[model samples]
Target: MYGINSLIKSGSLEAAYPLHSGTYKWTVSGPLSDRQIYYKICLKITNYEMPRTEMEFDSSYIYKCYILDCINHFGSLMFFGFIMGRALDHPGVVISNPVSEAFYRNCAGLSCTFEMAVLQLTIWFVRSCFKMFTKLIIPYLNVKKRQKQHDSKFPNQKLRQWESDYLLNKSERYRIAHEYLDTVAEYGYVTFFISSFPLAPLCGFLTNIMHLRIDAYKSITLYRRPNAKKVPKLICFTKLLQATTYFGILTNAAMIAFNSDLVPKEIYRMYYNASLEGISHQQFSKIPTSTVYSFYKYKANEETCYYNQIRDDNQNKTLLYWWILAIRFAVLLGIEHIVFLVQGFVAYMIPDVPYSVQEQIAHQKKIQSDRRETEFSFNINRKKSVRETERFVLIK
Candidate 1:
């Protein structure tokens, strides 16, 4: 859709930077080390860095400037999550020997809970920022017609030109890799700490609403206004999404298997334990809803005692739990690999450009080649005519 839209040269493509070859220079003030210079210049010729030969900065309005030298982008997000998890993870202080009934929600799962909460929050925050900022600014970008309107209506207004090479811009230095970095953080970094967090979707709802207005203000006064560049695709983002989806699947399975004690034992025992015994599943399923409560962990201590659940032949239980978790992980891992192969096969079979579009492009290229050839022949003929006339004059 975006490719077709951009093919029509629409202003909506402003969210994407042109994928072209161009000279991009560093205009940063600080003494850049040799390695830093190499990475910034040689490595990043064409990126969000330099969409054009020159990028103009807009300083008509003032915005907040922070000394981010002390701030580590990756560390900050990770630490924020860790701190939030720790701060909110108070499950009635830490108990040395916790007691949990098969009926009770085990609080020992706080670590997993904290880990999931942190990851979900981080993912949602990054998502909110990306979606909000990208949507708000693309409209007013180098669409000539819109720029003309802004000029006619507000001649005195000063607009921020595109800060493509924002790394050089000390004030907005973070903008350089903000989008990609955020996605990496959400999909890659936090997931490493723990598998899955269910609250991400819920958290995204609140952040999206708030970021809508925040980004609107930021676009008008804060960020640079670059001309609309056509985005062929978000290849990187799509990869991230795919990778995260696979991870989410495996992570959810792990979370459920591990956190069984955190939820109702009936859920775990009836469903998970059912797999261990064929008869129990049939028996449990045949029971009525109201009477099913009677069939639950009717044990004298298993219903009220966490230690009884944890310590009673706990070695066997621990081994079984781990074996189940490992089996689940392996199965999911295999499925991911299969899905990846299938996706690659499908992609290979499918061409990015449709046949009709490819034909149109080919026709346009042929027309251009014919026009150029005719112009070249005309030039040669004119030159020959001039030479012949000059020779004839010389002979006379």
Candidate 2:
């Protein structure tokens, strides 16, 4: 029955049929008088409860989590390549000046990343508190409500005791699905918009480290032992990770190229020999004398100064704008190709199974085959000896 239940749960079987627990009745045919017979039978099957003392933690889960963290970190670095590679902005550029608004916008990404990290942590903390509260308090309230409906004092006492025992047992059981969902959420949060903040990996690491400790403490003190489940692989999460990897590469490339000042700075440095300060001063000097009504800010501006790096000729994008735009696209394409090539090279170089492990697996298979052959020969010999001994005894 346990095997059947396991098979059903694993999707290897449709159902276990014709087995039930109930009173069965049938008419007796051989009796002197027609009589009906009734038999009460009950068959119950349940999962073998894993004891807390015997629970073996799988280290692969931890390794996978760290691997995901590393990926997110690396993706963030790639997204903000200028931080490590080259100086994109001028050294003395003032962040507060309206002319340096582009640089400010770039810096805003970092701020957003930090904000998101805080938000994720706060959400996890609140969720954990709520879960603990409901687990401890809700069942007691339910028991109290049931107690009010029972009128007899003695039965109520027995009922309360049973309810207390049930609640204690229930509180000990851990819901693994909740943990799995939490991990998934954390993974998504770190990987999906990682380009917006290069420090996301750091935040993720701190969160995961704390989360690991909390989970360990809960398992030890608050929750009962969880059932041991055997899974071939984390198939769903593995696929999700693969998809995220590809998406991250593309997303980081686009983010660096468009969201940051890296491309424009490069274009300005290579194509135009003028300094950003000089250009800003020239644009400011050329500002129209006529007062312009700015509806967005609801203010009248004496000078119509453009904060963007585009040309001020009739407010239309100049050749430099198109050139910068093209360069950005080129950078995006180049990054994707280079990253994918490195990924392929690394994957090819690293075999999933090491040579040592492969040899051990082969040796085990060989031993099993040899044992099976020996057993087969022994079985044949025993059958022949048994037939001969029977024939000899009959003849004697």
Which candidate number has the best TM-score? 2
Off by over 4 Å in 2: 1-165, 168-174, 193-195, 220-228, 274-301, 309-312, 376-396
**lDDT (10s digit) by residue, model 2, range 1-396:** 112234335543321111112111111111101111110010011123222432222323333443444443333333233332122221223335543442223322212333334444443455445544554455446645544555345463554544443433243222553365356545655665566655657766776786787667655544434557776775355555576678778867876676666765555556564454343322221234243222223133434433333554454556767877898899999989999999999989998899899999999999999999999999999999999999999999
Every candidate's lDDT: 0.40, 0.48
> What lDDT, from 0 to 1, does candidate 2 have?
0.48
Query: Ten consecutive residues with minimal summed lDDT in candidate 1?
Result: 58-67
Error of 1 at 104 (Å): 20
State the lDDT of candidate 1 residue by residue for 331-355, as single tens digits: 5566556756776898788987898
Q: List clashing residue pairs in candidate 1.
A: 14-228, 99-306, 100-305, 100-306
Candidate 1 stretches with Cα past 4 Å from truth are 1-171, 183-199, 222-326, 345-360, 383-396
Could you tally the backbone clashes for each prediction? Answer: 4, 1
